[model samples]
Target chain A: MDWNAFLLSLKLAGWTVAILLPLSVFIARHLAWRRYAGKAFVEAALALPLVLPPTVLGYYLLVGLGRASPIGQLYEGIFGGPLVFTFEGLLIASIIFNLPFAVQPMQRAFENISEEIRDAAACCGMTSWRKLWRIELPLAWPGLMTAFVLTFAHTIGEFGVVLMVGGSIPGETRTAAIAIYDRVQAFDNAAAGAMSALLLVISLIAIGIANLATSRAGARRG
Target chain B: MADRPTGLDARLVQDAPIPLNARLRCEPGEVLALVGPSGGGKSTILCAIAGLRNIAEGRISCNGSVWYDSEKRINVATRLRRVGFVFQSYALFPHLSALANVMEGLGSGRNGGSERRARELLELVRLGGLETRRPSELSGGQQQRVAVARALARDPEVLLLDEPFSSVDRATRQRLHRELGHLRGRLRMPIVLVTHDLEEAVQLGDRMSILHHGQTLQEGAPHDIMARPANREVARLIDLKNIFQARIAGQRPGAGITALAWGSTRLEAGYNRRFAVGDLVDWVIPSGSVILHRRRRPSRGIRENPVHGRVESMVRLGDTVIVAVKVDAHAGYPLFMSMPVHAAERNSVAPGERVGVSLVRSDIHIMPALQPDGHDDANADP
Candidate 1:
C-alpha cells in the first residue's frame, strides 16, 4: 500500500527478471536441445513450484536457509548474516516461485524450431556457440520476452513465498502484495483498492508492451 | 582423363555397422554424383567427409591430409575441415539476412572482404541483388541459391550437396542444375552431390557411384553405367525394360558370339567370357535401344538379333513412347521397347497390333539370374 512497499516490490521483480532471463534461457535450451541422463526428472523438478502449494515451497526454503542449514551457513560465512529475512533471500524465493512460468514458454518456442535449421548450421561448420548466438537465440526472442514479462508480473503478484521467507521487513522485504494484505487486515479498503489497481495497470501495460515487441519482431522476420 | 588430386577420401565405420564404406577418388575439377534411393547412406558418406558425422572406425582424408581416423583417435571438427555443405532443406538461417547467412562461415579476419565474395557467389547462382533479404522473404529457388552461395563463400576444398534440387520447382531445378554446372567449371572443387533422381544423376555426374543398401553397386560414367550395367539390379535401376530368361543355344567360336533362345524368339549376342555352354542366363536389353517397325522389312546383309511381337500397351512419357510388346505366347509378361514419339508416329504402331523389334547383338547383354532378393537386378549388365 505504501510507496516504500511499492518500490520494494518493483526492485524484487526487477532482480528476479534480471537473474532468471539468462538462467531460464539456458534451462529452456538445455531441455529443448540436449539429451542427458535424468533430463525428464530434472525438468519435472524444475516444474514442481508451479503445481506444489506455495506454502510448501516456502517451508522448504525456510528450512534450507535457517542459519543452521548448509546453504544458510555458507551465506552467513560469506555475507556475515543469515539469508532469511533479507532482500536477497526474497529475491531468490521469488525466482524459484516463477521459474517454470519463465522457462516453459521459452522451451516450447525452442522446441518449435525445425531440426533442419540445426542440421543446416552443423553442415555449415558453425560451432555450437555460433549457432546458439546467431541462430537459436534470435529465433527465440519473442518467447524469451514473454518469459521475462510473465516472470516479472508473477513475482510481483506472489504472496505466500514472500510471507514465509521475506518476513515482511518493511522497506527490505515487505513487497506491494504483502503490503496490500497488511492494509486489508487493518481494514484500510481504500489503500488496498489503490494498490490492486496499480498492480492491475502494471500487468496490463507489461502484456501490451510484450505483444507489441513480439509483433514487431514477427513483422521484421516476415 | 588427366589425373588430379582426388577431392575427398572418407571411410566411415560406426558401432552399429559401417553404413558408409567407400573410397571415392575424384579429380579436383570433376563432379562425382552419389545417386541412390532413400536411406542408402549417400548422405552419410558426405557427412563423414565433411566431418559432421563421427566415425568410430576408418579414416577420412581430404586434400592429402587426414581429417578423421578412428584407430588413431583423430577427428577434425566440421569447422576445421574446410569443407562446404549445402543441405537438402537449404538451411539458411531465418534470422539472418541473405548476405549475413553467406558471411557466417567467413572468419572474422576475412569478414571485411567476404561480403564482396558473398555477392559474387550469389551472382554466380543468379541471385544477384537479394543480399539484404532474409530467407523467408525469398522463394524456394532463391533460398537454395543463397544456401549454395553460403556454402561456396569459404572456397572449400570439397563441396557437398545433399539433394540440392529436391525442394525446388522443375523450372528452378533446371536452372539450378545449369548454375551448378557453371560453378563447377569456375571453382574446380570436387563437388559431391547426392540425388535420388536418376535422370539428374545421369545428366550432372561426370562420374557416378550407384549405391544400393549401403553398398556401391557400380561406379563409372553415367552412360557407361546405363549402357553396360555391372549386374541386373543396375540394369533395372537404369530403366532397362527388356529382361528375359534365356538359355545358351549355341556359341560361334570365330565370331566371338553366343546364341540365346527365349520362348520362340532366338537371338545372337556377344559371348560373355563367364558364360558356359549350358548356363541359363538372364538377358537385358534397354527399351530405348530397341527399334520398332510395324511390318517386317527384308533381311539386311547381316541380321544380328530380331524378335516378332504384338504391341500390348503403349505408355507415352514426354517425347518418348514406351511400348510393351508381347513375344510368343507369354501369358501376361511383355517385353518393353522404348522409341521416340516421332518413330512411333512414323510406324503408326498401336496397342494389340503386330510389330517387329530389332536390336544389335552388341545390345543383347546376358548375366546370371538375380537371387530371390532382386538386389542384383538394378546393376545387371545391359
Candidate 2:
C-alpha cells in the first residue's frame, strides 16, 4: 500500500469534518427550531443520500459536475477544467454521501433540548444570534462532534462514491478504501491485507477519541 | 433609599380583547406580591411590565420612564428596559458556573470587576461559596438564589420574581422567604413577586393583590385583605370556612339589620347600607373569627349572631383545630367553626358533641350574591 494514499485519506476526512461541522449545526437548528413550509420534504431530501446506493449519488455527482451541467460549467469556467473524474469531485461526492450521518445526530441532540431553556435565554434579553453562539452551540457541542466524527469516518471508508466519481486517480483521489479495492482487483492480496489493517487501526482510533470526547462533555454537563 | 422612583404602572392587552389593566405606585424597598390562580394573567402582567410580552393596548412606565406604549408604537426591548426577572424554573445557564451566570447580566461597563460584583450579589443571596458550581450541581434553592443574584447583577430599578420559591423544598422555601425579606429591605428597587399561594402572598407582600380570571379582585395590605375581603369569592380564596346566605331583614340609619336564617334557627346581624330589605346576600365568618364553647354559656357581647351545633368532625392542622359543626338550622350545608387546639383541648370538645358557636356582628362580612356574569370587581383597590 502507498503511504501517500493513507495521508490523502486522512486529509480528505479532516476537510470533510471541518466543512460539515458548521453546516450540520445550521441544518440541525433549522430542523429542530424553525417552522417552515415543506420542512418534512426538505428533511426527507437531506436524508435521501443515507439510504440511496452510493453509486446513485456518485452518478448524480458525475453528471452534475460534468462540462454540460451548470455546476460543471462554473467549475470549468473558474478552474479551467471539468470537476468530474477529479479529486475535488470525489470530496464533493463523499460530503453528499455522508450528510445524513452528519445531520441526524445533531438534529436529535437539538430536539432533546427543552424549549424552556431557550425561553429562558429569550427572557434574559439575549439576541437570537448571541443566544445561538453563546448558549445553544456550546451546549450542543458534543452532538456536533459526534456528527463530525461519523461523517469523517464514513467518508474515509467510502469506496463506491470514489470509484464512480474519482475513477481511482492514484495519490490524488484514490483513498485507502479505494486503494484496497484496486489491490484486491489486481490480485495483490498481500498489499490489500496491509491496507485493510491500516484502515482498521485508523478507524478504531478515531472512534475511541470521539467516544472519549463525548463522555467528557457528558460528565461536564452532568 | 434616595427617593426611589415608583414601581410598575402598566396595562396589558393581548390578542384576546379583554384588557388587563394595572396601575400601581409602589415605593422603593416595597415587595408587592401578585397572587392569582393559573391563567389569571399574573405572570403575563409581570412579563408586560418587564417588556417580555407585547401589549396591544395601554402603556407601561417604570421609574418615570416609558417602557412601552401601544398607541404611540413605542417599545423598549427587554434588555434595555433595566428590569430584572427571575423565572419559576430559575433559568440559569447550565453550561456556565454560578459566578458566570450572575456576571452575565452585569453588562461590560460596570466600574468594579465583573467577578467581584458577581461575588457580592451571590453573597447577598447567601450563595457566596457556590460560585464555581454549575446549575445542575446545586440544589433547587441554591439554583434559585443564583438566579436572584443574576437578576440583581443588572442593578435594576424593578425586580420581577415569578414564583421564585415554588420549586424549592418547603424547608428551603422558608429559608428563601426569609432571605428574600432581608433582600427586599436592603435593595431600593421595588420587587414584584408572582405567586398562587395565599400564605406566600401574605408573608412576602407588603401590599398584595388578588387576581382572578385576568382581573384583580382586591388589593391591600395582607391583614386588611384577610380581614375585609371585598366579596364572597375573595373570602373563599382567602379560605374563609363559614359562608352563609342571609336576607336583609331591615335597614337602620347608620347600620342595617339582617337575619341569617339557618334551618331551624335564625341569627341577627348588623349590616351596612349596601344591604337592602329582602335582598339575598352571602356573608362570611372566617374560621379564626368563630368562637366555640363546650357548655351552654350565657351570650357575651355579640350574642345576637349565635347558633347551637353538634361537632360533626374535627381536623387538626398545626396548632389549630378545624371543627365542622352540623347546624341543623342551616338547611343546605354544615358550618365549619375553628378553634385553637389549646382551647378545644381545655374545653374537652370532641366530634358529635354539642357546642355553642358565636360570632360578632363585626365579624360577619355581607355582600350581594355574585352577578350571573361572574364579574366581581374586588381587585379595584390597591
Q: Give each prediction's DockQ, rounded to 2 decimals.
A: 0.59, 0.41
Here, model 1's chain A TM-score works out at 0.94
Kindly report which residue stretches of model 2 are placed more than 4 angstroms away from their true locations once superposed.
A35-38, A63-68, A74-80, A122-130, B1-5, B15-27, B39-41, B44-59, B70-75, B109-112, B255-271, B294-299, B372-382
- Per-residue CA lDDT of candidate 2, range B256-360, in tens? 556654334665666577767777677777776777744544446436467777887889999988888776565445677677898898887898888777776
lDDT of 2 by residue, A1-111 (tens): 777788889988888887777788889888998788999998999999888888888888888878899998999999999888887887777777888899988998888
Q: For candidate 2 chain A, which ten residues in a row score worst on lDDT?
A: A116-125
Worst 10 residues of 2 chain B by lDDT: B373-382
Candidate 1 CAPRI classification by DockQ: medium
Candidate 2 lDDT at B206 equals 92
lDDT of 1 by residue, B1-382 (tens): 6554356766555544446656576667778889878887888888778776666678887777788888888888878888878888887788788888888856332355877877777788788888899989999989988888888877788888899999999998999888787777787778888999989999899999888766778889998888777777777666677666767888887888888866556788887777777777777887766766444354562354666778878889999888888765444357788888987887779888888777777888887766534322232232
Local error of candidate 2 at A209, Å?
Answer: 1.9
Write candidate 1's Cα lDDT for A5-123 as tens digits. Answer: 99999999999999998899889988998889999899999999989898999999988888889999999999999899999998888888898999999998899777767766766
lDDT agreement with native, every candidate: 0.81, 0.79
Please state the interface RMSD for every predicted structure, separated by commas.
Answer: 1.9, 2.1
